[model samples]
Target: MRTREEQQSDPYPTTVEIHCLNQFLMEDWDEEWDRISEELEEQDIPVPEGYYEIQKQILDLHQDMSVVEILESEEDDDGEMWYTIIDVEEQKIHPGMPRYALMFADKPYSTDIFLDNVFRHDMRVPDSLFPQTWKNRQAAKYQNM
Candidate 1:
């Protein structure tokens, strides 16, 4: 194992642990699809027929996939740290998967951190929040972008 001094000297000190949101968050796939479709509509993008079915099949496989690479890390306007990650293993296996995710940094594996905050972007869709419940959560909950 690297010594503390060595670890501290490293430019990139991120220790990426493999974790799945599926284990922590009970996602409503219907609400997720609805949010995605609405986001698409707002952007004037066409929602392809059968897109929801395709997304369902992809998310079903996400339970075991956790090979993520942090592509970018930034703090939003509210000062919450968020990381834009790419699911490397899933991308290698299937390009159709929503491989890009924007995840909260403070609570990377917490269900509360992901409450209506999980956003996924893929080749077919833009950065869209899934399973959104803005009505229930506070306005701050919707400011992760």
Candidate 2:
């Protein structure tokens, strides 16, 4: 586990290694975005470019979600760290689990740490549970950058 100070000082500051199982749900955005976009297009509704590329997707557990497990975290050929997460039940249901997805550390995801631990917190990741001091520090750090 990386300390909060270390995470804050990191140049990239987009990688995180979670303990094991963490609950998360997609926040502020629908997981069925593509399908929704298609429906909107069919209805002649114009979709904004902001929703085009998927980046910094929020992850907070939905009420319907059972369990989310962090299988592993590894960097890709491009040196981008990607964490493999899977739905436990989904994997059991389908061998080729469609719910399995790669999550970037830069993205938003909910964790129980804020309610329990703070020394290992990462301010770069947005979460309402994070202390205000850490949030302010993160903001200032980015402003200077």
Candidate 3:
């Protein structure tokens, strides 16, 4: 039988392996996206809205995209910090587009933080906050874009 000292000295095996694999897969996905984007642009394709969605999926599988894993931190108001895990193949449905999907976290802690931090302020304000005319204008922009 191993002594307490022996167990303490030995590091966990599976965790390290998993971490390495995650890192490798993320790098591979990044490279793949670069190549795919170039090809799409060269083909004069409008780069389907689904492209980002698929990239998000790839990042999800490799644990590379947006997620909110709460961490214990003194600085956090709730003593929890957010972390994200990305996996490929997970589809996110958007409000405007049905066929188009985005790659977003399976779970997010703060909608504000997710929009501001994770999405880099790219999200539109909730429709309730906008006037009917403004909403229609925004919709038109999306349709035309």
Candidate 4:
């Protein structure tokens, strides 16, 4: 888990750990991705870089994913990388399963901690309550370079 101070400083961070993931979640991850990739290539579909990471961050922000426990990708037998997002306050991923199961690995990608639009335009963020901002918002908007 990361502290708020940490997130505020760099909301978009990169990681490749398979933290706290279930075996069932990533049953045949590598094969699935390989198949998908081949299919996309055959169709001449442009493969988006940082594909998995971008999707995970979007899901997190949209569902307000709380905290994650990582198991690191290289440690598993199938190299089965996985992680579980848990609500630190409640200590559960909604008292059962998480909002979604996601696959990650291969290419490095930037992931958001929470607030979307805080980083990559390539990322996704659903509609949600926004924090009141002063001129800092304008300052940030202009500071982007």
| lDDT of predicted model 4 | 0.44
Q: 62-139, model 2: which lDDT tens digit per residue? A: 223444344445555776554545455555321111222323232235454434545774458557778765676588
lDDT of 3 by residue, 32-143 (tens): 6579779988999897667777854554466443221111112246543322222223332111111111222323343455464364546776768867656766778777
Candidate 3: where is the Cα deviation over 4 Å?
1-28, 54-145
Q: Which whole-number lDDT from 0 to 100 does residue 85 have in model 1?
A: 46
Residue pairs clashing, model 2: 24-60, 24-61, 25-60, 25-61
Residue 118 displacement (Å), model 3: 38
- Model 4 scores worst on lDDT over the 10 consecutive residues at 64-73
Clash pairs, candidate 1, are none
Per-model TM against the reference: 0.27, 0.27, 0.24, 0.28
Per-prediction backbone clash count: 0, 4, 10, 6
Q: How does model 2 fare in lDDT?
A: 0.43
lDDT of 1 by residue, 44-141 (tens): 99868887668656655665435444444556577655544445556422111232222223325544545575665565633345445534454567
lDDT of each: 0.46, 0.43, 0.38, 0.44
Per-residue lDDT of candidate 4, residues 1-145 (tens digit) = 3323445665434454323234223346546757988998999998688876786566545532223432121224654433334433445442222223433332234345454657545666533445434345566876685
Supply the global lDDT for candidate 3.
0.38
Using lDDT as the measure, name the better of candidate 2 and candidate 4: 4
* Models ranked on lDDT: 1, 4, 2, 3
TM-score winner = 4
